[model samples]
Target: MNRKTLVLPAAAVLLAPLLAACGGAEDGRAIVVGTTDQFIANEDAPAPLDPAFAYDTGTWNILRQTVQTLLHVPRGGGEPVPEAAQSCGFSDKASESYRCKLRSGLTFADGTPVTAEDVKYSIERVLKIKSDNGTAALLAGVDTVEAKGTDEVVFHLKSPDATFPYKLSTPVAGILSKDKYPADKLRDGFDVDGSGPYTMKVEREGEKAARFVFTRNPNYKGDIAPRNEKVELRAFADAGAMGKALESDDIDMMARSLSQKQIRELTETPKERIRVTEVPGLEIRYLGFNTKAPSVKEKAVRQAMAAVVDRGALVNGVYGPTAEPLYSLIPSSITGHATPFYDAYGDSDTARAAKILKDAGVSTPVKVTLNYTTDHYGAETAQEFEALKKQLVASGLFDATTRGAEWSTFRPAQKRGDYAVYGLGWFPDYPDPDNYIAPFLDSDNFLNTPYVNKVVRDQLIPRSRRQADRTAASPVYAQIQKIVAEDVPVLPLWQGKQYVAARDDLTGVEYALNTSSDLLLWELGRGTA
Candidate 1:
């Protein structure tokens, strides 16, 4: 789930034009990172930087790593290990209620001591205001969260949940400094005084505005495998530009999606100078069909689209080996990864797709609109969709029209089923395959599919969520994927291969699906090793 590379000192003298001209070395020490999407300023950054908001990956990486949680993922995969809480377990035998006791001497960035009340407020406040959309869904079964004492917090679950603490460990549930943030809405004020190991110096609205800056938390107390003073994140227009910035040494690292061509260049670069580590990315990319359309609403029409969708061609031509052909809704690394979809639908066959469409009496090509985030993923996304359009039209199956919007408007619009089809990528808020299947596939889910899948809704998702342990949940997840094939809510595209290009001097950084998805910024820069 995590990997480490030799860390280069972020403070290392980077190659500078004038300094190099004089044969003088430059301290290329600042660990500048590059990306295509523009980042909003940190001051204007939305709410608690607390995990409860768990909305965007960019905010999570900045806020999550700086804080300690009651639970966290240890080196290898298993249940979360106690970090802030010295000892924690079920408060009752049924495992419905849970409690945790904090480690002594922990304090916030403001030097005010950390307490169980802070954790209670962090969870309870979000429950009370519910300003943000997804927080309530994440805290679904929670009946109450109470501060039992100065050091202990008790959670009362509406249903028995073995994975409740794991859910709490996600960024959305990140603890805040109860002393600083108001119990109500922070979405407008951008007040993020938390107990994280690092604090934001500046976070702009997006890269086009200015650079995002961070400073080490002076009053922080916690354990980090590798420690560093500060971090800065800068965004660019597309992966092509981000790659160029890295090659030119304008930035020290990058964690955003890269084009297949960019990956080839990053990996093929001499191993001596640049560091490229390919990890199993927890990100899921979807080619979503707007089933709200009368033409696409029919099962046969949806199936035809899936039948003609060439995932292999999409990856090979559009993304290459940097990504793999994904058939199931969940990734193989997940416990509930299912092959049911693949078993039912199989690979693309244009002839079969044509027949399916024809038999359904869809003789006329369906003119559909495809939408995508203009800035989030990368430049190649539009091209990839264009390639898919060519393939679909070459077979005389369907006609496609493409459109774009920035992620802010685009996400809400697609979720509202405003477009005929769209490209969206998901970074799991939590690592469970349930996170994959539960959120996206459920017809009522926020990323709601317009197609109503009775089997998936009534049985599969609920059954998987009810399974006491995750490993026991696979059969239901497999069933969900199979139902997905029959209903064709969205086309499963390619599973991404994550690439992080950081200066060679940075080390001990790894990305996890649930928590921060950070490069473990604490493990970055200015190390003696």
Candidate 2:
């Protein structure tokens, strides 16, 4: 996932512009939602809303509501259930082949018939384009996606993967109209031609999405029944403006972009009209090292940095009670969670960091630049990076500097190895331990870092995936986390707590988010408090 920038809390004047952007509220028929997620478009990522190139949480939030995948993770959360497909499962005991039969009478937003060919084409286009930041790597196990007849789609995997079904549930596998989307290129413009529960009309400001108006899809053929007839998602400059809109009754609900201070204030001083719901989230923030960079190329340099960093202080000072220090790639709630980082570092000792540099014969006052986005994560991200710099500088072994850039430029620069280290936040594509670790460690990792481990990437991950029972893969995952701690390619910082604040009259705020934290706008509607 990409991180946004931090700005000082907004003044009351910031509220006026956001309120004007609401375009006059509906007569209690449409639910106006507020967020600070700005989707950036550039040459590398010309279409931020297209599934083929879209990977960030903000883009995925819009895609999930408008696009239909073959299967979907239920609101309450559990095993995958068919959405576009009438039925789907592994066809063989090896889990190398899977089949799905499409539901009849399905139609895209443009009213084109949905077919198995669309599924095959959609999956193939993602692999064909293979955009650098796209999710093609997630489907790397697939050898071929075949359309057998008009209703049946088959996936032939190169290896056994029990998580194949779960992968299909994500927007990466969202079905698209073959006629609308080019086979070798990403579809441009803000228009969506999906067969999901809701059809969207986007209002754009330059390259970013300003507002999205979603109406129930009359052509939809799925299990979801949208509780609200219409819903409008409005983007803000920062969380402070979003909070103000929520307070002034300009929007019915606020999505997951609230600042740490905003969450505390809302929780501590409960508003009569507003209600806050806190859920355990899979969101995690970490610092990724560019292993090829001169400042941190040596293993000793990375290890020493990790040893000196304090995650506890990061939580207490920056994130407050809204987050907890995370020591492993997988959060504690996951099945194979381990504390390898804690095991190696043992709670930030300056002496240990010094010994690491001394033992390796590295020079003191190591110089490195830390880069973070200026507009994506939250208002406190800058504070978080500054705190990190202070900790590193205080170690007496390193000189650290922090840099900020808007996400549009920051993401591509990180891919080009512009900084020694950069910050990133991950919202899982699916709620699995593999989703947490694979994207960072796999050969085609999301981070363009040069670090690669053959054992973790080629051996352990495959071994773990072959097991149908997730619990059976626990030991293998534990070994993977241990290798991460030893290598220090990425440093786990903290796991976030999800807070969704909405008008008390809203009925489904508690159920609007899936396990991976994707907002399900269909679940929201007006009701008695």
Candidate 3:
């Protein structure tokens, strides 16, 4: 929809400027925001705000603003800083023991004291529950979490992990009140007892309940100060609807759901009306193979398929300039990113791929099933997979069939090995090189792929995590990337740039799009027109 066609009445438009002049807090209106259906769907909704069970970005988006972590990665990104804790540090040079002192007089939204015991309980609960899709995997290094005293918490690790501090900064490690959450099971319902910048204002139900409201938390003890008294998160069916809402000023900002077409249009035509914030790329889209599938069980076949697919064509044709061809699981902006796929497969080499298949005693026109989620990865996903099918069929070495399901069904089916090959996307929990390497390669990885290399899982990853300076550990990650490329468990497709579109009058849009690819709602504020 065009700017002139926006549904907002002229009276409201005129009043908005006057309201901004009077200040955002005086009106007692929530700053409305919108995202795509995939975010608010029954399978993907950020409900049951229990930090221990909350793993998806939708959940983390709200938790990051409403629930405080011991440490937090700053907006532009860098070293972690104290959030709930007054200060935290490694107790020994080996980096095996870590300790943090809780800030004095910390309290949840309900006014219960937040102490070191709550921090310990929050971490212990995650490990104890260990949900299949939960972020507990990120804390695998920790052997135990102990409350040394009323204000002090200590962590004992199974081995040295230099990235442990960064892990604490993630939503998975968000400190929850022991009194609010039970020790044995995930907390029920949408009620949140968080101590971050904002707290839940209203928990609505039924067909009409499409928005979640949050008001400023009076008990927040962190560095973040809420710029608006209230914030509202609204869900939309698709990018077109979200764009229309943005144009009509129905929402103050749109996060993580705008399509490439919408993004490009808003960026070019009405640049003055909306401010678009692009954070450094950290998201990776890749093709995963289920090794148990007979058609792709052979390493040579997998390598040949990788060789036939052109990443350059996929990125430029399907994603436009919104993404870049990624050769490794790690995005190029991050340190230790290696283009091993380029070194091994080069550009689509149909002849070489055919030869490899023939050499492996595999016949021409090998049957393969390619699976993708239509709603999970945005509107371009179907087109992207179609492009892949076209390229693979053009090679004349294999017959590829494409199928799709909505995210809720797609995720579980993929994990259950329902597809021979599938598409997946990853937004890192932390920016460290280990976060990219270890998650996909470890023996018990999130991918559930049969491929596993001991050198990577047992040696390279451990060696890299032990290094105090991540730069010193770069070569190890490079080595791991090369191994991953060679194994072809998953083919790296492209890395995406983060975008947040807000009204021109909204302040702190850039700060809200943090380097971790998380939208920090607390950073947003209204500005005078």
Candidate 4:
């Protein structure tokens, strides 16, 4: 699944003026990458930079570059390959026990030896700390992590999990330096000391800021090689400004933040200087119902809302061709994707939705509030929400009111169950079908809803994950999707297509856009001109 690209020599560090003069590096000069503010992470700030506490995409981008995991998905998009681990496999046929052997002579950035103890400590710390909004769900099946010796670590699972190896490849399973981080609590700082592909250097105009610099990690023992000696991630205020910077040669690449209009415009007008790569992404945008809320507590009310949602119109009207309608929680590219919602509801029929509500003994025109964040999802989100409101109100089964919040406020409030129904987007933590089903449906989910379906959390997901062959688990996933469609705790709105727009001279752009939709910053470099 991973692709390898031709790598060039590290570029010599250039002065500020010369760096901004060209999109590609002059022979042996650094390449500066420009991105929207969304991609930048503040390591110095308290925005959850620690592996145990971090879950956001910006932090994941930084972590993927600066931290090494036991295994990792290749840049070209394939199965998990050994990174820090020299080798890894299930010790038992039931997949109840898994083990890994660390590469010899591995050391942290500070020269401390990385042993199996460090691996055990990292996993234990995550389980012990247990951040409310973090990625603990990824390791739900893990019973214990024990260090057998200096090089060997064993994972004892409560049940068989075929996809356990893929989980270790995520940032959630990033190995940490036992000497640098505390064992009891989460670590906080501007400095990074992990063994990964790159080492970060933070520069701030203020005490706490997002912008920073990354250089190739000399101590890194992984397979990936840095194409540029230094990579500068410059953050702009918005997508429009980021696009302008790319057009004007202020930045070499625009990473994952541009709107549909901007992408189409770049495709049509620029024809020569810029190149865009659109790949099918695993990210899902959905509407989550807070089951605790009075307005959405009834199963019938939730079903009616789901029945009236026009996913086709939402994609074509707001997101354009950059995204497609998603009827199942698992996206189309994944093996278990089945159109249960589409089959059950059938293209936003208002009369059917009205009849469903009336038959449930509910009154006409149920009033409910919809919550969404403007800054987090994208600039196009406001339009998407407005379109959703129109779709619901037009059905005449409900009186929908839409509200907006900035992401900083929105995330905590949504988790607190403040909204009757809310819009949330998910970028996959791993590529497995279990990832789509487990995290959202489990009782102890990130959504913080009062939904506890034993059929899904206890039975279906466990059965599905235990199957080594994902194709064998497809029917179970289809059943899970059908249950989701019936309950309507969340409505699958759309799945996005990944796009990375860079100057034509940039090589390794394909390598950067991996299957997980995470950018491999190290693979991107200037082409010979």
Candidate 5:
């Protein structure tokens, strides 16, 4: 599962926005998409569409259409190409200084011309707000941004970071109008202003966006063209309902949130009118340890838990074939991925786990409370945790208890270190090894754990970042993964595979997902075949 979204019956809500798009659907110029992705649209911190705070893939899917970035990953995943910018690259060989030339005649959704100052303001505002729920830490390397002129922008980095452009390709660096958004505060609304391929109008039901209606933006001037005139994204409570909507012809596509059973039915049975496409995904689920916590404070205790986990059994039993066992923070699909955990502790060995505890002078049946978010990670998550609890307890060397909360409360509590151990998922902000390793191990890490290794934080990551060629950084990343395995700051669980189920008549369903797993709705349209 990518993220959260509220569910509503497809036929029940005939809202005006949806009705308008429905009229165009008859002509094959309009398409309806269903997803289980969700976001919070409240006054306090985040409001879904705010570029600074819209960090999840669900929100990014909507933003990718309406909010334009300087660069963008191409259809079906590849190197990023210019979107709002005509050209962008590092100005120096060290990958420390980067520059971009914006495409001329660019205009925001509000009809205001987009200038370099707006780009500068957009990047700076994200850094200034620095919301914990946001991806501000991705811009940690940036020292300052300068608007050289109306069409040119330069970024001066605190250090060398070859992955910076990939970060820019994400919605984290989405260009917004300076006049439309405040410099120091998150824009507190579902409305958005950008120069992407579509103009979006959000229909709200309380704090949730019930539906997102996107009309083709006539003023959008970029590398890609919209294949359809309109797209309506319908929110489903669960994958079951979303699948039903696709089967009943209520929606043309179901993306990012399909359950394993739904995927199996779509792929195995071969629905004549429907088809499913599977792509390699960068999404991963893991367990984070509050290293200062009493129970897991000892390195041996954490290592014991890691050695006892049977990733193969957990993935196959709970997730079917939809997910694969993951040993490293970086997925095998990403370059520089190494299996240090497997190298250190191979498979489930209760004797090995017991010995680890005994060597550390720790007693048997060490009580540990495991926490997880109930609502966000799909229906199977509860089963996954239950399976995990059984595994730990079955080892006869530990006592494990499971606790869960809704995402709204769970995330804040995890950040506060309320739980000794918690499970969380990561979908890449961009498709790179740095996106996997840096976020957890960096100085101001997203995990907020007390575990710190100066060598990994200060030396290995920075050394890897300096290489312009990502492949050249492989050995450094290998060392970093080994350190993570040894320390057990966070235990890697499983890596996911992306799937999208759409009507067989859809033309561009195969190319709708980009390199970073962000949905590009502009690629979808009715097919002649």
Candidate 6:
């Protein structure tokens, strides 16, 4: 099993100013934001809003900012603060159960009371739809979710889950209205009814690249302290177009998916016009290999494949200084970040890669389909894939084909492991390194790679989960990354240094520590001072 260190929360303010350059919202002005996505998928429908099921950071960020949770990871980087639940802590350590007493007078957008029954239903829904959504795996070892009344809900776990409340802090844990929901269908694209600072004004369906919109809920009196009354999510298909729109004041801000060259130009532009915040990012991009594939069952072949990736080149040519080459699945900013793969197989050596394949009795060239996403990540994604293809071909051990889909199409395909080898980037749903390891390494997870380390699956992850406090779980996650370095089921590519460009006049933007993708809208307000 892996050994991770205790989780030490840090201040998220360091890189939050990146979104401040758009020069708007100084005094109660509405914040009009521009994002890489062209559409906003229904945050509440049958889709995965639960943190355990939802892996995309951007989605989680938007959802969390808009919804009410029982508990929350605190802002400005400290300990977790309570929300829907007024009082929460380990109710019983022996059984690994967590208990919480809900806050009074908290109601949904419709002025309906958020009761314990709704909380129970939300927890049950994660496990019930786990097969396709898979986020329920976050609670796999949990036993039952029992609520005492409208004011108290207790999580009874099969094992210890110290970070359980953080799980509750996710969109997945957003309490659903017992009236609108039924027991049968928990499909994606269902209209969401959440208790948060904002409500869906105009949210598009499957075509999230089409139209996604939200505004502050007049009834919302939750943790999210939104600065503006209305926030518009303007979608641009291309980063180039998005940047131009920002320059022309057509959009107030641009997110991290902009091209590297574009970021440079934006950053180098007069600071008075733009602002940049380089939060030591922890978005870890990786190449997932389906170990279940008959051909990929060979460990030697996997090792050879890991060897040929030139991570340094990827950062220099594709991402520039705003990014860093990653050898470990966990980034350095996180507590247990380690470069296990780099320790084992650092650089491309075609001769060695070829020998490893040959020693495994593989004389025929291996064929693997590589997948990429064009819309979700950034413009350089295609270039990164082409670089990978050339590097692998140069190794002479394999021939590869590259394919890509828009974010809407690529995500489902990536989760299903439909492609032989696909590139996926994880912006953590929460801060801890365990969040990174557990989601990807868990045997029952979406990748379904069939790459099991009994020690990890059965021991370490459980060990980390049961610890009630953050400090207790660290050692387990650290060891998990170390062991992962040796197995290399997925190759770590680069850690995205999060950058947001905003008008210099905008203020109060908050960021999460490392890869924990929490954007506290409450902390953002006009600069009245």
Per lDDT, the best of the predicted structures is: 2
lDDT agreement with native, every candidate: 0.66, 0.85, 0.79, 0.79, 0.84, 0.68
Candidate 1 segments exceeding 4 Å error: 1-29, 41-54, 75-77, 131-133, 178-180, 189-191, 203-209, 223-226, 442-444, 449-455, 466-469, 509-517, 527-529
lDDT per residue, candidate 3, 247-273, as tens digits? 788888888777999778776775557
Q: Tens digits of per-residue lDDT for model 1 on 33-118? A: 66555544333234435455546676666656566677766633457777778778887877778888887888887778888888
Worst 10 residues of 5 by lDDT: 1-10
Stretches of model 6 off by over 4 angstroms after superposition: 1-29, 38-54, 187-190, 203-206, 209-211, 467-475, 510-515, 527-529
Q: Give the TM-score of candidate 6.
A: 0.88
Tens-place lDDT per residue, model 5, 85-173, is 99999898888899999999999876899999999999999999887763788887899999997999999999999888888988889
lDDT of 6 at 297: 67
Candidate 2's clash total is: 6
lDDT of 4: 0.79
Positional deviation of residue 464's Cα in model 6 after best superposition, in angstroms: 2.8
Clashing pairs in model 3, backbone N/Cα/C closer than 3 A: none
Best by TM-score: 2
List the lowest-lDDT window of 10 residues for candidate 2: 1-10
RMSD to truth, every model: 6.0, 6.8, 5.4, 5.3, 6.2, 5.5
Q: What TM-score goes with each of the models?
A: 0.86, 0.94, 0.92, 0.92, 0.93, 0.88
Per-candidate clash tally: 36, 6, 0, 7, 6, 43
Candidates sorted on TM-score, descending: 2, 5, 4, 3, 6, 1
Model 6 CA lDDT for position 115: 83
Worst 10 residues of 3 by lDDT: 1-10
What does candidate 6's lDDT look like per residue over 12-99, in tens digits?
A: 3343434333223545555666767544444322354434356565666566656678877765454567877788887674647788
